[model samples]
Target: MADDRHQTPASGPAPNTPDVVELPDVTRRDLVARLMKIGAVSLAMALAGGGAVTTLTTAIAAESTKSERKYRYGMVIDTRRCVGCEACVVACKQENKTPPGVYYTVVLENGFGERPDDRPLFLTKPCFHCEHPPCVPVCPVGATFKRKQDGIVVVDYDRCIGCRYCLVACPYQARYSDFGENYPAIEHDTPWADVPSPEYKQFRQRAEGKSPIGNARKCTFCLHLQDENGRYDQAAGRWPACAKTCTGKAIHFGDLNDPDSEVSRLLRERQAIRLKEELGTEPNVYYLV
Candidate 1:
C-alpha cells in the first residue's frame, strides 16, 4: 500500500482541458472595419463611373440642341410683283446644266388677263423647303436631309439608292429623278456639265454610263452660287440665283428666323400665303397676294 494515492489518478480522460479559445471582440470589430472600408471604396468607384456617364450624356444633349436650333433659311416670293419672266428659270438651267424637261424652278400661271381686273398673274414655284420635311423620312436611304444649321433640304446623290420614295412623298412635286439621258444630238454638247463643284456638281462625263439618272435631285437654293466667292456681292444682296436673276425682284431669300431680314419683314408686312396650306407642310416659300 505504499504511495497508492499517486498511482490511482490514471482515468479515461482529463477533466480541465479548457474549452477552445474564443476570438476577442476587438478582432471582430477590426474585421468589420476592413469590410466597411472595402465597401466604401467600391461605392466610390461606382459613383465616379456614374458621374462620368452623366457628364457625357449631358454634353451630347447640348450638342444636339445646338445643331437643331441653329438656323433656318427660307424664301418669300412676292406674287404681286412677278412678271412671268423665265430669267431665273433659264439661269438655273444654264448654270446648273440641267437637261430638257428638268427644271429646278417653274413660273406657275394663275390667271389670264392684261388689265388689273383681267390681268394674268404668275407664281414661280420651287422647292418649298419645308421645316418638317416629308421628303426626308420617306427616303429609303438617308440621301436627303435638312441642314442642321440653315434648314435647307439637300440630296446626297452618291448616297441616294434611287428608291424614289422621296419624290412621291413630296406634296410640292419638287424632287426629280435623273434618267441618264445624254445629248447625243448636240455636237460637243454633253448632257452633263464638266464643272466640278460642291454645290453645282455637273454629273457629266459620268463614267460613260453612270449618271445622277438613278438619283433624286432638287433645288438647293443655289447653294453652289453662294459657295463661290463674291457671288452674293455681284447679285447685290441676293442669296439665291433665282432671286438674283429675277428682273422683277419678286423672289426673296433670307433667314426667316431673323425678323430684321428683308424677306422676313416683307412677309410680316404683307398678306403672305403658302401653297397648299391645307396640307400643313409649313412651306418656307411664301407668296404675297
Candidate 2:
C-alpha cells in the first residue's frame, strides 16, 4: 500500500480535473465597443432603409438608367412664388408667335376667400407631357407624339389633319385648336405677320391654311430653342420662354434624368402635386403646393 496516497480513489475527482472554468467579467470598454458596433450597423440600415449592400445596389441601378435614357424634361412650378403677372403667357406668344386663341400656357387663379384671412392662389398651367399622353393614341394622322428623345410632346404639323381630337383628349386641357384666327395685326396681313414664327425653329411666316393654324397646338417647352441634340443653353437665353420670363421665378425647368438638376432637386425636397393624378397619366409637370 506504499504510495497509495498519490493515487486517488476512482469515485473521487482526479488531480487533473480542475474546478469549473469561469468566464471573465465583461469590462466597461468591452460593453462600449459592442454597443458602437451595433450602432454603426443600425445607422447604415436607417440611412439605406435596407442594408449597406442594398444601398450600393440602388445607386448602381440609378446610374444605369440615367446612362441609357436621354432625358424627360419637365417643369416644377412654385405656386407660392407666382405673382399672376401673366409675363409667362406673354413671353410664350412672343416666342412661338402663337395666334389668338392658341395659348400654349395660361395662369389659373383660385380664390379661397371664405374668410378675410383667405388668400388667392395663382397656378401656371402647361402641357404635363404625361408618361402616357392621352393625346397620343387619338391622333388619327399620327401627328402628335411624345418625343422619344425627351418627354416633350410634339405635333408633326405636316401630318396633322386639322382635327381637334387632341384638345378633347388632354386631361389638363393643355391643348388648343388653332382656328387660323389671328390678332388684328396678323389678321390684316400686317408686317407683323411677315415676321416668321420661331416655332419648331422653322421660321415660317404666317399664312392661311398653315400648319399651326389648322393643327392643334400646345406648349413645345420652346423646343425650337434646343440644339440639334435637343439640349438647351440656358445661359445663352435658349430655354423655355415661360420659365425665362417668369416675373416671380416660379417656374423651374430641367431634365428629370439628371438628379442634380433644379427641377429634380425641388421635387425631392418639396411637397409637389400633379394635376388629375387619378387618371394615371403620370404628368411630368409638378406644382409645389
Candidate 3:
C-alpha cells in the first residue's frame, strides 16, 4: 500500500487533517507606534482628569479663605447715645496730629432729619473702610489701598502725589487733600511743628515740603495703636482714639467678623443701617437707628 502521508487529497484537506495558516508580517516600528498611540490616549485622559481636580480644589480653597477672614474691624454707632459733642473729633486730631481743616472724623448734626421740631440726630462720620472702596481703584499712583488682613483702608503718603483724585472718587467724602496748611500751634518753628505725628507709625514731623503735607489723608481706624498682630487691647488703652473718647459710649468698635464681638452683638440686637447702601460700597461702619 502507498504511504498515507505522501498521498494527496481530492478536496482541500482530509476530515481529520489540520490546516496551516499564514499571518501578515509585523515590524518593530509598527508595534512601537501602536503602543505609543495607546499610551498617549491614556496620558491625555489622566491629564484632563487631573486638571479638573486641581481647578475644583483651588475654587474650594478660595471659598474657604473668604469665609474664614481673620478680622473685620468695624464700628456700630448708636444714634441715641451720641450727644452731638465733638469730643471724638478732638481725640482723633490729638492722636493723629492731623493739620487744620483735615479732620479724620466729623460730627454731623441732624443727619437723619431736618425738621425743626424733630430731635437732632448727631452722626459721627469717619472713613467707612468700605469692602469695595472706590477711592482705592481711582488712585493714579496707587497711594490708597484697603488692607486685606483687617479690611482697613489706608494711604501710602510716600506714594501720594496730592492729585486729589481719590477725594473726588470717594462718595462718602472721606478723603482730604492737605494743601500744606498748618495751625498756630503746629506752625513752622513752633513746638508742635517739631513733634512727630504717629500716623501709620511713621512719626513724621512737620516740615516746609514733606510727605503728608501735600498728600491726601484719610482715617486708618487708628491702626497705629494696634499691636504687632493687629489687635487692640481695650483694657491696655490701646484702642481707637475716637471710640475710646466718646463720652456717652456711643461708638462700639471691635472685630465684626467675630460672632461674639460687641459690634456683632449690637448688629444682631439692633436695627442698623449703612450709608449709601445703594452704591454697594458695603461699608464696615453701621449706625443703629
> Could you estimate the TM-score for every candidate?
0.67, 0.75, 0.76
lDDT tens digits by residue: candidate 3, 138-198: 7665667776678788887877789888899899988888888888887646777778999
Residue-level lDDT tens digits of model 1 in 170-200: 9998888877654543336554345433344
Q: How big is the RMSD of model 1? A: 28.0
What TM-score number comes out for model 3?
0.76
Q: How many residue-pair clashes does candidate 3 contain?
A: 0
126 in model 3: Cα distance from truth in Å?
Answer: 0.2
- State how far residue 198 of model 2 sits from its true place (Å): 1.2
Clashing pairs in 3: none
- Best model number under TM-score: 3
Reference-based lDDT, residue 14, model 3: 20
Selected candidate, larger TM-score, 1 vs 3: 3
TM-score of candidate 2 relative to the true fold: 0.75
lDDT of each: 0.64, 0.75, 0.77
Residue 92 lDDT in candidate 1: 75
Instruction: Name the top lDDT candidate.
Output: 3
Show pairs that collide, candidate 2: none
